[model samples]
Target: MKQLMDLANRDPLARRWAKNCAFDLMFGVGDDHYQVEVRGGQIEAMRERPSKLTSWDFAIAGPQSSWQAHWAPVPAPTFHDIIAMRTAGHITIEGELTGFFANILYVKRMLELPRIEGWLQ
Candidate 1:
């Protein structure tokens, strides 16, 4: 996850999307959640949780299969994008939406880090 942030930080688009982005966000797959805190355009911390997600800027939650597909080395069509997954009834979004919508590309890029880094499972 740190590597994901590091990669995103290097991208001009990502940096632009992250400008003034200071908030806590999280995503869930099945029973697990990863809460991430961002400050000054960089990741402050990320912690694993079991539904103890308190305040957050946004959240992306989906089934394990959906997450697996999203992280796949070569994802299938619908799983390749967050909105597509949501459209297909595979994922859900919650919390503040302005930031989420504004930095959507960057957020999607972050979620695709595992694939870009060849950390596919």
Candidate 2:
């Protein structure tokens, strides 16, 4: 997944997707979680955490199936978007959400990199 994050720095469109959206966030699958810190369109850190230490602007969690479907090259219906997943009860979002909701498009695009780069399939 770090590879997917790193790809953003190399993509003009991806970098732009994160413009003015600096913040820390995490993704949880099963019991393991990973934090991704972004600053100025660059990923400062993307590491797995045993447990939460500090807070995040937002966090997204779901079952491995949801995550896998999300990383599909072309997802189906509910898997196509985070909001869709949440609406369908396949994923959950938490924490300070104003920033996340405001930049949902950018955040969504950033999260889609795993599939965009063919790193998941």
Candidate 3:
């Protein structure tokens, strides 16, 4: 997913959406996890976390199957968006909500990069 985040850096909309926003987000795909640092609309880093205690502002976690479905070209209903996935129990979001909510749009757009890139297809 680091590649997906990297794609966001070149995306005009993603860059604009993230302008002036800085946050650290942890994305979990089953047992694997990644920490993505965004500063002033650029993704500074996205690396796998070796320990669970690694610091991050917020986290969005779900099983691999859930993520795969959500990344599908035409995602299944409820899997198309984060809130829908969370409400349907397909994913869980935790940690500091203030940062998450404040940059929710950016986060959402970041997550959709794979789909937008047609990488999954």
Candidate 4:
């Protein structure tokens, strides 16, 4: 996750997409879960367990495999696909959905960065 975040921070497209945006990432691992929130590219909050708060501007959640698969290819996965899967119970999210779909291309481009690919172990 640090590798991915580092790549995102250095990406021009990611920087543009993240400008003034708050993001939260939730991952499920067996009986335990973890969440991290980023505001203005810096970690604002992090926690375990679910909360009623929906303060983020965008949110993404999934198991490790699903999350990793999003960075597997040059184009990566689309927001539409991720949302669709979430809606179908394959993933889960809570927060504002606005602008997230619009920035899918930017997220994909960020995943395609050379530094990102190099850290894919």
Predicted model with the maximum TM-score? 3
TM-score of 2: 0.88
Clashing pairs in 2: none
lDDT of 1 by residue, 1-121 (tens): 5576677678666677677777777878798888877788767678778356377889999888898888888889988898999898889988899878877866877777777767765
Q: What residue runs in model 3 are displaced by over 4 Å at the alpha carbon?
A: none
Stretches off by above 4 angstroms in model 2 are none
lDDT of each: 0.79, 0.81, 0.89, 0.54
Per-residue lDDT of candidate 3, residues 86-120 (tens digit): 99999999999999999988899988888778878
Q: Which residue pairs show backbone clashes in model 3?
A: none
| lDDT at position 66, candidate 1 | 91
The number of the candidate with the highest lDDT is 3
- Residue range with the least summed lDDT across 10 consecutive positions in model 1: 44-53
TM-score of each: 0.83, 0.88, 0.94, 0.52
lDDT tens digits, residue span 8-94, model 2: 667777777777778788878877788878787677888888355767888999998897898898989999888899999999998
Per residue, candidate 4 scores C-alpha lDDT tens digits across 47-73 of: 767675634455555665555454454
